[model samples]
Target: MPTSVSDRTGYWDRYAEGRSDHQASREEALKGAFGWTQYPGHGPGDEILGHPATTLELGCGRGDAVAALAARGVAATGLDLSPVHYARARERWRDLPCAQFVHGDAMDYLTQTDKEWDAVYSIWGAVWFTDPGELLPRVHDRLAPGGRLVFAHAPAVPGAYGVQGMYGGGFTGRQVWIYRWAYEPDTWSSILADHGFTDIHARVEPAPEPGLLGTLIVQSRKSRPHRMDDLTSSKV
Candidate 1:
């Protein structure tokens, strides 16, 4: 039980290029490994986040989704904490002018960047690693009006922290205790409401086995002032 989980870069760094190892082409990797084909922005660029929209992927490992978005004419930036992951992403999409990759802490990047985005998405990325209190507001601030946020998260397994349900594996072979806040379904909705996100929805996709909780596909739109008021009234 390694208690030192403050830094995850080293762990992810060694596993950065694992996506490339599994699938021959980037498109195949995105579909097989990431399930990008089933995401919101998979159709014509304009139908989802809007064509030529500015987008950001938090904890973007190898920048597969970012590269896909850029290919669809979106201005996409992939922020990753692992230098190896960042370098891999940069190299993968170097020729695409619309794609960019940055290596740094996700919260630090969000707090410092002045750029606003039309949409921000993550696929089991930093949203899990970071505290929701610190991460959500920064994300809300960075998204432009009408901006969308979506992420796929697995339901937290039943167990006490550090004792059970801890998952990790890499070259180091050290089993570090995973740090994740396991809250109920409504708790996620409450957090989003508090952060001024409207039209919040969570779809539970069934898990592979019975009796196991499924994945939560959460989606929300940045609420306008009027929408916020409406949400408040509806809650009361």
Candidate 2:
């Protein structure tokens, strides 16, 4: 796996090229899927997001889900590390006025942006690739009060926790690799709670077919502090 940002960007650019023909159509993109299950519309849908007015998607590959949310009247922005994916997304969904795509690293964007989002999510995206310990706090800080954080990715292989390296793309003989984080559902819940999140829900959903890997889905909300007026009124 490449350690530098520029190298990682090149890796994803090649990966995108290998899968260029796999882009979803406009109608199919409107109905998004959160997991890699073979079954259509399987697992949780966007309803778990709770009708957010604005959303930011970390590692929004191809920007299908971002476009989907925008179609539902949410102002959605997708940030990706792969320039190829970003360009493709912009050209494909340019008609959607509410949807936007930006090419950049997730951590850098999160650290620099002053804007807060009603909800932030990733689908087999940056939340998987980036270090949660470093990434979660930044995500929490950028969320509005009671904002949501949701993500879905494949469960870790047995005994494989934290950063795991794997090869990607269709390259033969060349070892093009990438790094991802993997944790059990319980560990994921604990990590979110420790990061000051409330209402944490993390679970593994079975794949549509037997012998296939299951998807790990996690959802949590930023805790809203109690107001003085509400406390005083409750005392009366």
Candidate 3:
């Protein structure tokens, strides 16, 4: 199996205008998939974000959601490992007031960045690239005490993608979305629970498209100091 996945952010820089061949179609599909409705910042931007908010969009491909957030007047940043995609995101969100793009590993950038954010959200699923073991700790460090993380993940049976994109035309083939890890909701929940996030919730969304692919949406609140007290008060 081809182990090295395409560096999406870096990969986009090499593409025409930092977009894949299906960029336009993909946009239309997402628009069609979601009915082209604008979000009123029902995320961290739900209430407080309209004022001045910090948000991170992990693996932001062309930054559609980031643009959405900015449209709602939120200060948002996007991080992706592929320099190509990062460039693409930059171009997409360049007009926004608080939009910035970074090209690096999600874990590394989250751990290393000193900025604090109110919320972090990743759409179109990016958790497949994570190393599982290391992903939790690094994500924990990036979050503020009361931060929220929402991961829109694509779930599959374990080891399912060993054939599809791995054996394709160098991962550049149209409709090639090679994701590792079966990504059960419980698996991701346990990971978040272990990383000091509380109030975790996961739901399988209605497959907004006509297919077997599924989106497992997980939303977790980063624990505050009170959480430790909650655990400690269980004295007999």
- In the range 56-101, model 3's lDDT, one tens digit per residue, is 8777766666666666567878777656677766865576787777
Q: What is the per-residue lDDT of model 2 for residues 1-236, given as tens digits with 9 covering 90 to 100?
A: 34533368888888788885446667766665334333557877888888899999998888888887888789999999999999998998899999989999999999999999999999888998998988999999999999999998889898989888776644574566678889999999999999999999899888877787778889999988899999999999
- Stretches of model 1 off by over 4 angstroms after superposition: 1-4, 17-23, 30-52, 158-178, 207-213, 225-236
- C-alpha RMSD by candidate, in order: 5.5, 2.6, 6.0
Please report how far candidate 1 places residue 56 from its true position, in Å.
0.5
Which 10-residue window in model 1 sums to the lowest lDDT?
37-46
- Give a tens-digit lDDT track for model 1, residues 63-175: 77787777767888989998988887898779888999999987899999999998887777888777787789999999988898877666655443212234567347676
TM-score of each: 0.77, 0.90, 0.69
Model 3 regions lying over 4 Å from their true place: 1-52, 158-179, 208-211, 227-236
Estimate candidate 1's alpha-carbon lDDT, on a 0 to 1 scale: 0.72
Clashes of each: 0, 0, 9
Error of model 2, residue 142, in angstroms: 0.4
